[model samples]
Target: MAVALTPLSIPGRAGQLVSQLGDRAELHDVYDETGSRVYHDVSVRDTHEVRELVALVRRIPGAVLELAAGSGRLTMPLLALGREVTAVELSAAMLELLSERLAEAPERLRERCVPVQADMSSFALGRRFEVIVLGTTSISLLDEEGRAGLYAAVREHLAPGGRFLLSTVDIVTPDDPEAAEAVPEAVIAAVGAGGRAYRMHDYWPAGADTRTVTIFPAEIGDEGPVTVCTTTVGVLPVDQLGAELGRAGLTVLSGHPLPGAWRYRDVLLEVGVTA
Candidate 1:
């Protein structure tokens, strides 16, 4: 399950949408069964971290453990590396989609992936991995305590001289300062891998601790049932995250900045166990 979920809400345009749909609106947690398909469809359309992540993984040689391996976005590419990958996920629904995708992959790649249904914050694989990944900024899904537990688990699961690669949102200070107020929220039209169009709404205020995201069908009528996926994501500043990692006995090795738009940038941090 998606951890420490803040209350889900449909505000602004999406709220107006719900008001229009009335009883016809079907609300779903983004990680739920029906929503997992939507997540998978959308994930298949994204290429955000695949290249940078795979490049880093290629330098490391050994088994891999992917946390919150939803719908096999990074899982598939990680398997393409020809190393044994253990994909740990909390959502059975998401894992189901991943399993189906793996079933259709080439026999060689199909045989290398091991999918396990388990929480990313707390899991015992009874083994270690050279590369332990928690991509998609998924570490933000957990609360403080949960993140601490995750760090401990990662430490326990890292092989000798291993590295833990994770990505988190990086806050960029604008030169104008007024740029944040100028863009409080944005709605973008995107076509998913399933060839369905969606209107994504992201409401993130400057310096806010959390952001609310809502997705709706690009073409929704008033009468029929409409599926709306929503979730709340917490923002973990790079400095704060570094401190947390230090407290957990993990030392930051290097940070690589990723390109992004709309007032948000992602940074992939390479960390190792503190000596």
Candidate 2:
């Protein structure tokens, strides 16, 4: 299927660069087939919440279900815990990448992993899991309606005494709108595991309920073609998310702050079904 690419109107230095590139820019959604390659390339070596998330998973013992398990970033670690891990993903490209990684893994690790193509917002494996993880703030990728479905699906799949762990951004910086507006943007240069250098731009305005992230090659000559990927995700507050979970018959068990110094910090929330 040929996906029609839309013109991306970025809002920062990256956007300006795209404007200058004009016809040279090839825009893609971050999760698209081509862009997912770039995501897998960089994420393969990135470790943001692996330690904390795996530690949380270790406390509970049983089968694990990882939602939106792109390219098995956390899936491999979860399988390393010596448990059955079902990694569900929507992108076939990403799943292909994960399959490649697992193929090279030792039989001890590879055999325990079961890769399934499914949507995290709504899915059913006809069974329950002791630990279900939705990391990388992937929940924000869902709209309000989709998130409702995600919560419902989670509730249906949790075994008795099971825990659902997810990570999200928690704004902990300046409270005033003026101060927040002044320091809410960041541009980072990152090198992927494939040795490709990329410039990532993140911009979130004060009082806005969403943030935009755009990525492109860090070094681009005045050339013929350049691929740019961008994605916008909602900003979910802890209190709001807790309320939504409560309405869906789930409750927060605990919260752990991950290590970071961004204006908005990542908080891992452990949730369980209501009694």
Candidate 3:
């Protein structure tokens, strides 16, 4: 499927606006437009907690599968560590960037990683995995039925004694406030070699316990302004999440804060095959 590409933009402060987009494809484009330094800085500022989740998984063994692999940030790192990896993603735009990165990767690393374009809810590869991961709070993307189906699908693909690791925001916490009044932000920034810079910002209301992102692009060159694109996402609570997993026939091993008392968003879970 051909993905519609959109330029990164923000109305006022482009930097903050791009920060709000926060999706894999937009972030990848920002990295391509700026540089690794900017990308790393932004990642650290926005997703610092993900590092802890990475550390936790580093101790595990065998092939790992990442559902909704996005632009392959975590998946690539896993391959660099010599772990066999398979990625399943729904967005063609994100997967395209993932494929590009994989092409530039070392042959050995490339050998360890494979990308499959498919939804996490019902994709079947006819194989099981030692470890399966769904990152970036992917579970919340699904409705209740989709979430349940995804749990069953993950369980079906997990090898005996294997585990599934997932990370999500704990929306039930008091800090989240009632979802009706939340404002979502999306920010983008870029600088040209001529010392000129451009930025874009977008904001909108996301549903209850949800985040909405829009991208706008500003041209430092002779081009005009344009609104890039938008994507919406949802967040779920831990207790309700566990019930969903239970319905999928998986057992929870752990769900807690992600090591650093980061934001109210907790790691929320680890599930293993039921005996």
C-alpha local distance difference test of each model? 0.88, 0.88, 0.63
lDDT of 2 by residue, 1-275 (tens): 22454444577677787888988888887878888888887778878999999999999999999999999999999999999999999989889989999999999999999999999988989999999999999999899999999999998999999999999888775767676678657888899998999988887877679888888898999778999988878999778898999999999999999876457788999999999
- lDDT-better candidate, 2 vs 3: 2
Q: Candidate 2 — which residues are off by over 4 angstroms? A: 1-5, 175-179
Clashing pairs in model 1?
none
Report how far residue 95 has shifted in candidate 3, in Å.
1.7
| Top-down lDDT ranking | 2, 1, 3
lDDT (C-alpha) at residue 55 in model 1: 95
Worst 10 residues of 1 by lDDT: 1-10
Candidate 3 ranges with C-alpha deviation above 4 Å: 1-49, 172-209, 218-223, 259-263
- TM per candidate: 0.95, 0.95, 0.70
Name the lDDT value of residue 57 in candidate 2.
Answer: 98
- Judged by whole-model lDDT over C-alpha atoms, candidate 2 comes out at 0.88
Worst 10 residues of 2 by lDDT: 1-10
- Candidate 1: misplaced stretches above 4 Å? 1-8
RMSD of 3: 6.9
Clashes of each: 0, 0, 15
All models, RMSD in angstroms? 2.4, 1.6, 6.9
